[model samples]
Target: MDPLLLLFSLSAATCAYLLWFYLLARNLTGPKVWPVFGSLPYLFLNRKRMHDWIASNLCSTGGAATYQTCTIALPFLARRQGFYTVTCHPKNIEHVLRTRFDNYPKGPTWQTAFHDLLGQGIFNSDGDTWLIQRKTAALEFTTRTLRQAMARWVNRTIRTRLWVILDKAARDHTPVDLQDLLLRLTFDNICGLTFGKDPETLSPEMPENPFAIAFDTATEATLQRLIYPGFLWRLKKVLMIGSEDRLKKSLQIVENYMNEAIDARKEKPSDDLLSRFLKKRDMDGNLFPISVLQRIALNFVLAGRDTSSVALSWFFWLVMNHARVEEKILRELKTVLTESRGGEPKRWMEEPLTFDEAEKLTYLKAALAETLRLYPSVPEDFKYVITDDVLPDGTFVPAGSTVTYSIYSVGRMKAIWGEDCMEFRPERWLTAGGDRFEPPKDGYKFVAFNAGPRTCLGKDLAYLQMKSVASAVLLRYRLSTVPGHRVEQKMSLTLFMKNGLRVYLHPRTLA
Candidate 1:
């Protein structure tokens, strides 16, 4: 009896809601952020191109912008929102990371998302927990003992596992995913250094390791959580579906591996990183529980594994692209090796590269640093604002707001790096004398390993490891990418080359 009247009423309600949403959405300045979804409409449309999209927006607003992702509820009744004050400004990076350091921490959002994987580990925890872990790590990382162990591990792994694999690939003329080889190398090296166990992940056969596979799965899934809202992800988590399911099983695999490693360490009690960690107790003088030990293990594994492998993969890719860079690196390598070995080229290849010898590869270190500048493994990270704060760039961040600084975007910013920022040039890092490599004086400017008190503890070790591998590989073989193999970045906690770095290897003759 009233069908026509009901239809008119429904139409009028729709018009009212549209008018209300339209009024609220117009206040957004940078992009046409839609109501409820905020910047997500544009973000969703450009998900594949996020790094560039974000850089484009940051460039539009003088290198800073207030991006919002609101709940899709009724306009006035919006439940919660994700207000990301994203900045690519270096001054703002210093302000948040150093000058006003106390104002920011990993925060609840990051901790919550990474909790399952990282737990109260160094990367996830804030406050006292973070301090304790940092101190403990500082102790382990700075030790000459650990550095010696790391050098042995790297040299042995490269000479034994990596060399044999590449030799086979070169002999067979087989195309290999260099990224996979590097990942295996790092995984084997880290597992031996950290767990007092060797997974032998870099063997010539290149078989799959479940722990490595699961680690990759869990990290990528968790990275996805950063983009999803709490409600949507929390509901998926509750239902045991989708990414949550993958995360659940992956963590299970990772935790089991950790526990198994711990048991082996306890039974044997060798002097690896795990043994050192095992001996340390909490502030209460009680030995850490298995859970704590697992986090420690996972934390170190995560740090030691991805960062070096990803860095090397990118470094090799960059070096291959620039013949001049490769030639310069080779010349430096020959000079350093010949000089170090008393002009004995054959002995340089035959003998193991020690810490003292690797330390002399200044140009190699410079090349790696330059690669990190353009493509940092951990490209993006964020902090939570504790109180109302004014960034150095004059952006106002309110309490309970989130601020994410993209190291990826920072490296590409012309304002900080000059007009040639886009160009891959290792010479930029070299000093005026053009002989020694000098990093940016400001922490925030070269933020690949982070900055200030939270600087990466493994920085020195990373350099030592990368230089050793690069030297060993270059002395034996010339690596070129497999033709028609696409290289792209995988969306993950680490800046992994999505398609993997596939390469063809040609053996270099010492004669």
Candidate 2:
């Protein structure tokens, strides 16, 4: 009799607890929540289309402002019910990025996830560490010499390796993976600018550089840490198994390469970022330690390689799909070239577009911006809340909670951009005259380069590299997507094409 009564009491308590959980979960505006799993099941199910899923959730929450700021339940993975506030609203974005900038840092989870690969680098650190690196990097990015160095590297790669490979592919009528090509090209270019050493990953032979492979492997492994819970990855790391094991090996290769580069720079200084950092003194008038320099150099490489290459990959795919946009870009390029070189298309096409010429292609830049609007390289970013605060849309985020701003979702929100927000139209970025490029009035709306004080310092250099590459490729060759080749998005930290962009290149004739 006593045992039966105890069983009944326990069942009643469990039912009561479930009811309480349901009541609180039903009040949340985001994805569905189970008892123990919270929204983990939904997140897992929609993993491939995670960004679009978040955008759908935000859109369904009563127009834009009514529920633009939504929270996901991950009670098990995070502390205090594991609520993650995801926002796509411009006002909320402004609030989190600028208005409450100090209140949001990289947070422990972010820093810890990336610490192994990135160390205490600028991108992975917060407060004074990030500030010092930012101030130092800002000073360097502003120098005319850095831009010139970047241009030299980009142009040389295009003129020698990239063009050579593409020309051979065109002659052979072979389909090439354009995404891989761009990744290699940007890898080589960034490596040169970062350490004055070129991995030459974009050679005609298409060799794989150990450092590049290791860097990519480490990045992917690091992203896995963010996707899964911290404890699970930590256990794997301790056990020396799975992705963590691969990460360990990759880090070794990367460290070796970086150490070699650092040693080389010390022996004979160059104008690369590493050399500059070596010469510059910190606050105490002391040289940055070897570990700090290595991390800083790795951070630059990480930032420079994937973003522009991924953006260019999407830009090419978009232009291939939208012939009208491609034609407009070509027309703009031709006009600029005609003005610059008296219409010697063939002669100029032999070499990549110069920095001056690339800057003149306003329409092309607009197209690249439009591409980023549709497909940002870093689709979403996470920030840790330092204090309890309310977003512009009135959504409250408590301390220790995570806030994610979806760049992908922001570009698709009709309330922010117009009904035609989903469409790829560079004209939106131009004035009525269509001669000059004009960004949106509210800088927060187009945050492909991010907004506020932490905005990308490499914005100008990124544009220079993208414009040079895009103009050179479009002017020299007409790309056609291979039949039966599928283009799908890869669910990773960077927006990469899962199947890669496969296309055949045909020589362009200028009549």
lDDT of 2 by residue, 231-344 (tens): 789999999999999999999999999999999999999999999899877667888999889999999999999999999999999999899999998888888888988867
lDDT of 1 by residue, 1-511 (tens): 5999999999998999788877655543456656557666776787676776766776666544334333343554332246677776778888888888888998988889899999988888888888878898899888898998888889888878888888888999998888998898889889999988899888977789999999999998888788767777789999989999999999999988998999999989886888888988877778888998899888888999999999999999998899899888888878877877767677878856787888887778888988998899998888988898887766667777688887888778777788998888988888888788788876577888988789999999999898888888888788888888888887778888989999988988764
Give the top-scoring candidate (TM-score). Answer: 2
Local distance difference test values of all predictions, in order: 0.82, 0.87
User: What lDDT does model 1 reach?
Assistant: 0.82
lDDT of 1 at 503: 92
TM-score of each: 0.93, 0.96
Q: Name the regions of candidate 1 deviating beyond 4 angstroms.
A: 1-29, 62-80
Consecutive 10-residue window with the lowest summed lDDT within model 1:
71-80
Per model, how many backbone clashes are there?
A: 1, 0
